[model samples]
Structures are given as structure tokens and as C-alpha cells.
Target: MKLSPYFHDLRSAYQAELDDLTQDSEGKDVLRKRLAEKRKEIAFLVQMMELAPEMVAVVFHQGFRFARPMALEQLLGRGVDDLPGWSSLSADGAVVLEPWAASLAKAVLAEPGGERFLAVAAGLEFMQAHSRLAPVASHAEAEEDDGDEDAPEHDDDYDALSADDAADPHNARSREEASDNWLSDVGFDRKD
Candidate 1:
């Protein structure tokens, strides 16, 4: 599948911003730590979206494995939430960010128009693909699913009906008659 040029640009821009964050002197350590934490959070979110319980435990460990309190919940746990600017995200740059209250207001007030929404959606898909969240089942695993007893058994008449269906696109046989029901149905014609 081909990705839009806009998505490619968005990805490159995000990477450049991340690189800029890593190059700062005063908060270089902090930014690097946050970057690692962000990766784990994204991974955890992906696992949750996939409903993969087996991978959750592993991802959760990485999510909170940072040295400093990287999240609001973490700071609250240590009773450090009351401190001035405790919840503030400090970044070294010309970027003038709003406080949490202002940020929330800004976010609530902003409306993403059609093009912006599409860009965001495409960027998310690109990120998920790059992060390896795109589901990829091996040939062996796919074969195992077909062999698994839990999978529904292929009806006996499937072979004949499939052949007929392929040859005659306008065949009047209902999809159900193309399966085991073919032998049981009253009007079904058996070529045998």
C-alpha cells in the first residue's frame, strides 16, 4: 500500500522535532527519558488496542521503568502534585506552551477541519505501521488457524459450489447452498 506524500512529510517533521529535543543542553537527560517513556506508552496503547493481554504485562513494565516521575499519576503517587509547576512540561526552546488549564482550553476550543483531520489520521496510520502495530500473521500461524479444531469446519459441498460459483458468476444458488446445505436443500442440483 502506498502512503500519501503528506504522511511522509509529517513523519519526517516529527522526527526532526524529536531530534531537536534531544539536542538541548539543560534538559537533554529529561527529554531523552521522556522519549523512552513515550515509546513505551505508545507501545502499551497499541497492545491495548489489539486486545493482546499476553503483551500487556511486558509493555506495562517498560511504561513505568523510568527513573523520574514521568507521568501525572506517578507524581501524584509521590505526593508531589501540589508543588508549583509540578505538572508542567518544561522544554528548552522558543516554543511558548500554555499551562495545563490553558492547554485544555485551547484543545477544547480548537476544531480540526477536514484536511487537518485527514492529515492526523494518515499520520497515525503511518506511525502505527512504523511502530510495527500493523498485524502480520506468519504463513505457519495462518495454516494453524485453518487446522485448529475451534475453527469452523469447511462444508462438504464447498469444493463443488466454489468451482461452480467461479465459473458461473450469475449462479442462482444461495451462499448457504454452496456449503453443507447443498446436499440437504430441496432444489440444489448435484453435478455428481
Candidate 2:
């Protein structure tokens, strides 16, 4: 799955954003409630359509179902300025929305850069469904790294998807307990 640097970069951020919404402090599954809240804020979030599509795109998580894999893969190769308009993609019925996404899509369509952002949103979703969100250094980035040997090999993204595991109380509790024991060994009192 060849990804444009744009989609590649946003993939992790979008996943992380969803992961953030997936659980609360008590490790309860709060995704539905949080996503609903985000949907209501679509009007405000539209402002970030192009600048930070991943942040705004979360409102549409599970909202897109791409019918044409090739088209989406092609779309991922284009730079931001070169993206196809949403009208074309939707016209072909290549990007289908979940039944619940209609009004939110309409709200987004009314914005200036909304169409392009939708295509971006779809590409992000496509990458996500295919499990292509893992970090892969692009050709240019790899070359740039060779000159500076001190650069970090990876982005410090939280687990590519521990956010998914966070939904399980068992995983979250074990992790919490492990952290407490580690802290105790380090001479700090366990956090109650």
C-alpha cells in the first residue's frame, strides 16, 4: 500500500486520535459518546479540514467504506494540492458513508475545502482498514536520514494501536499494575 507522505503521516495521528477517544481514565469504553460529541462540533471542526484533517476526520471514523480500492490507493499518492474533489469520488459511489454519516457529511460539504478533505478522510480510512498505519519511512525521508545519523528511526507514537487494546480492562489493568510495581522499584511510592 503505497502511501503519500501526507496520508502516511496522518494515519498514525488519526489512529491515535481514535485511540484517545476509545477509553477514559477509568478505562471505560467511551468511543460512542465521544464520537457523538465530535459529530456535534463538525461546524467548528470544519475550519481544520485541510490543515489538520486527521483531527477533524475522527468524526467520520467508521463512517467511510471505500468501494474502489485502486482509486483510493491512487488518491493516496497525490499531494494535498493535487487531491481529487469529494464530488467526483462520491459521484462514482466509490466512497460510501455509513447511514449515520449523511448530515455530518453535508455539514462538511458546505465548507470551503470540504471536498478535498473528504477524499483525504477516505484515504486515511482505507489505510486504516488495511492495517497499513504502521510507520514506513518514505523514500525521501529515508534519504534525508542517511545524511544525519542522529535522527530517530521511529516516531514516538503510542503502540501503533495499543489504543485498541486499551478497550480491554484486563490489558489496561495489567499495564497499570506493571507501571505501579516499576515505580515502587524506582523508589517512588505507587500512585494509590
Candidate number with greatest lDDT: 2
**What are the lDDT scores of the predictions, listed in order?**
0.31, 0.76
Which TM-score value belongs to model 2?
0.69
Clashes of each: 0, 0
- Model 1 lDDT, residue 86, Cα: 17
For model 2 the local lDDT of residue 159 reads: 26
What is candidate 2's CA lDDT for residue 91? 92
lDDT tens digits, residues 82-175, model 1? Answer: 3223113222211122232232223312432322221232233224323332223233444766768885443211012234343574543333
lDDT, residue 84, candidate 1? 20
Q: Model 1, residue 43: displacement in angstroms?
A: 29
Off by over 4 Å in 1: 32-129, 132-192
The regions of model 2 sitting more than 4 angstroms off are 132-192
How close is each model in CA RMSD to the real structure? 22.7, 9.4
How far off is residue 54 in model 2, in Å? 0.8
